[model samples]
Target chain A: MSNLLTYISVNDGKIKRSSLEVLSRCNEIAEKNGKTSSAIVISDDCSTIVENLKSYGPSVIYTIEDPIFKNHLNTPLLKALTLAMSEINPDVMAFASTEGSKDILGALAANRNAAALADVSEFDWTGDAVTAKRPVMASKIISSVETKGSPVILTVRSGSYDTVEKSGESKVQSIPFTFDKNELKLTLKEIISATGDKVDLSEAETVIAAGRGVKDEEGRKLIDELAAVLNAGIGASRALTESGDYDPSLQIGQTGKVVSPQLYIAVGISGAIQHVAGMANSKVIVAINKDPDAPIFEIADYGLVGDLYKILPPFIDELKKIKG
Target chain B: MKFYVCIKQVPDVNAPLQIKEGELIQDANRNILNAYDASAVEEALVLKEAHGGEIEVVLIGPDKASETIRKALAMGADSGSHILTEGSEEFDSFSYAKILAEFFKDKEYQYIFCGKQSQDTDSGLTGSMLAEFLDLPYATNAVGLQLEGENLIVKRQGDTGQEMIELPAPSLVTCSNDMNDPRIPSLKGIMQSKRKPVNTIAVSDLKNGLTNGSIKTSVVGYEEKPKREPGKKYEGEPDEIAKEVAQLLDSAENVI
Candidate 1:
């Protein structure tokens, strides 16, 4: 039987839910096709991660434990992944599309001389080739892509598949790995984390994004208050982020993060195609814009035409009441 | 110091497009330099202005994409190289990266810059793939870049935060459009851009293993994304509508 491998991504001592989603999908595909599904976790210590991955229903779990993986560095991470590939030699390797994965997806593909597809919304193994649907043209169109060859490397977009929990015992295999600092080509000086302890925008269930219409501190305060009420992550459009009203990391658009939250509230956003490209997949979209003809309303499930200044206070109050 | 910024000409996403029998058709006149590549070019220009270096923008596209190279020169690049490709070739990121690696095999440069991803396809794979092919150190999704002696400090947007990475000379970096605003070409600058040298090389001239048979991935077709139908619009009486929508979200949507 062919092997399907999922790379489990760990950040801040926790397994990313998106990776679990990809693993679940791989497990399902393996079960249907009679392929052996496995998972690989690369980190400083893979013990905890391996223990957590058992519920995802992988037949085998591979762990590469090294101190070099404490932070995100492409050089050592690529080396570890390349080594793992040689040992397992899977037919298909999948990853969750994250900044960390994006950094190395192409390099890993090139390293193994394997076919690579990035940011696919949906993918399936065709026994001989892997077929996927990728969002192209600023996510306005879906492109059907097929990669023919062994060990096809692909990254799945977050929230593309549901994470299914299957309790079962899994075979754990620890892969030996090592790295020398002298071989490192780049040094990670530090991480300037702006979203410290806050909800990650991509993983958040609810996201409240501000835009140009959020003129000043008062408008930002309203966004903050509303997000606080809903316990949602706060994001910003390119306009607001470029204007220094929000951190660059929080920009939600074509040039920034693509998020598919359960509930997305776009306040004062004009819903430019770039902005819409990032959040169009949100389960429920609410657009609050003063202009009744704002393009955001075209796709928003609930379009509120009025001043965000006036709309936010009552919205926050009502949400608070409902929670109470 | 010398910088090579890789650029691409892509259809303006804002423009109207059509899909006929799985083929994507765009208005030819609306083609522009990819925005993220423009940022890379802009950052190269800024570094050249301060550190005193040469900026050469390289593009691999059809003959029509020459205008995009000229656009970069007009913005203050010293020269350009156009690796010409026939407009009809269906190349994925791997093909492009393979071709670029072949071109750079003999060239020497302190840094190579590219957009984190293309605007139209958004594959976001070519930069790192090219780096791997060249066996060079590289960083991607750089939102801020600074030069410290012979080292390049890249502030890249990570999954949860911004990572400050330091790479030595002769490395590659993929820039985000958030880095800087690309300068608009002035009238005089545009005129002078015509005088700047742009070396054109046909893709077939490179005698590598590059051929249609070598391509492993293909975009078979394209279809429209399932549309999200507009639900309800609430206008007038901001307080009432706001509260009404909030209640509905909790009760009807059950999302709260």
Candidate 2:
């Protein structure tokens, strides 16, 4: 039986839930195939993350700790991943499709001379190759792709699977890694975080996305209040983000973050296909727009024809009442 | 500083698409420069405008893809390189990266830029793959770019925030379409693009050209995504519908 390795993505010392989701899927695949499921974490200190990963049930946890991994630098991270691939010689290496993982996925695949697949929604191991289904043409269609090689690299989109908790006596091994400063060809200046301490959009169960209808401070205040009431992450459409009303990081569309939260509330969004591609996978979609013929209504589970400014205040109050 | 932006011509995603016998068919005339690559070209032009330098765009496609190159040149790039390939070749990201590496092996440039991903495929692998093949420092999903004394400061959108990264010259970066609005070519600019220099080279002419064996991945087939049917529409008073839906979210949907 071959080995399946999941790269556990850690940001700010906290393990990403999406990584665990991938691990969960891998664990199932390993069990079905009678193979080994493993996980690798590359960060400054892996102890805490390792402890957290135990619940996800990877048989082997590989840790490569280095100070250089404190920030998302492609060079050192790629080296560490290549080293891990060589050390483990896994049949398939999977990753959660985060920005950090996306930064290094291709480089690592190239370095290892392995076949790579990005942003797959569904995947399974077939005899010697890995077959996956990924969204193409801006999520308008799904393409079934096959990667024929050993040590296939894959990055799975978030919310594709459910995270299952299966505690086991997992073995943790620390891989030896050291980086020379001269090899580091890039410098991380600083991170500009607009939504500080807010819930991560991709991970949150509920997301409140503002659009062009969220024009001014008053509309933004309503969105904030609604998000606060629901304890949801705040997102924005390209219109709002491009107009400087929201941070670019908050943009939800084909060009920005793809979110599949349990509940998504679109405020004033026209439901452009590009925008819909990012959140169509959301379990329950709620749209509030003035236009009755908006395309978003075609996909929204619950479409309310009204101005967001008027709808949000009462909606927030009702949610607060229910939450209390 | 000399900048090279890699572009691709992709079928317009907005255009109507049909799946016949598990193959996707699109209108041939609807092909356009990938939006993300257009942003890269725009960024290159902005950089060249600020700093005295030349911006050249490189594209790998069929002969007809030259129109995409002209589109970039109309956006203020100095020249173009059309790496011609047969329209029927089934090449994956690896093969593309290998061919681009060969083309740039002997070339000189301070920076190479590409779209974060193609609009049609959305693989998002070629830029970083090319970087690894050429052994260059690189970043992806850059929302903003700037030039320091000798380094390029890239503001990339990460999972949590916008990361400001600085890289030395001769690096590669994959740009996001969120950076800037690509300019619509003016009549005069389109006229000038006709006279601009574009060096076309066949894929077979590369030092070590691509072979079918180099492609490790292939699309087995295509299918329409499962459609999410619209549920219910409530057109009533704002407060009535808002409160009604909020209550339903708790009692009916159980999501609250």
Candidate 1 per-residue C-alpha lDDT over A42-144 given as tens digits, one digit per residue, 9 for 90 to 100: 9998888888889887989999998999999999999999999999999999999999999999999999988999999999995898999999999999999
Candidate 1 Cα errors over 4 Å, as ranges = B207-213
- Please provide, for model 2 over A70-142, each residue's C-alpha lDDT reduced to its tens digit, 9 standing for 90 to 100: 8888889888989999989999999999888889888888889889999999999844789999999989999
- Tell me the lDDT of model 2 at A73: 82
True contacts kept of each: 0.89, 0.88
Residue lDDT tens for model 2, B162-197: 899998988999999999999999999999999999
Error of 1 at B121 (Å): 0.5
Interface Cα RMSD in Å, per prediction: 0.9, 1.0
TM-score of chain A of each: 0.98, 0.98
Q: What TM-score does each of the candidates earn? A: 0.98, 0.98
What tens-digit string does per-residue lDDT give for candidate 1 at B140-221? 9999999999899999999888999999989999999999989999999999999999999998875394765457799899
Interface RMSD of candidate 1, in Å, is 0.9
* RMSD over all Cα atoms, model 1: 1.2
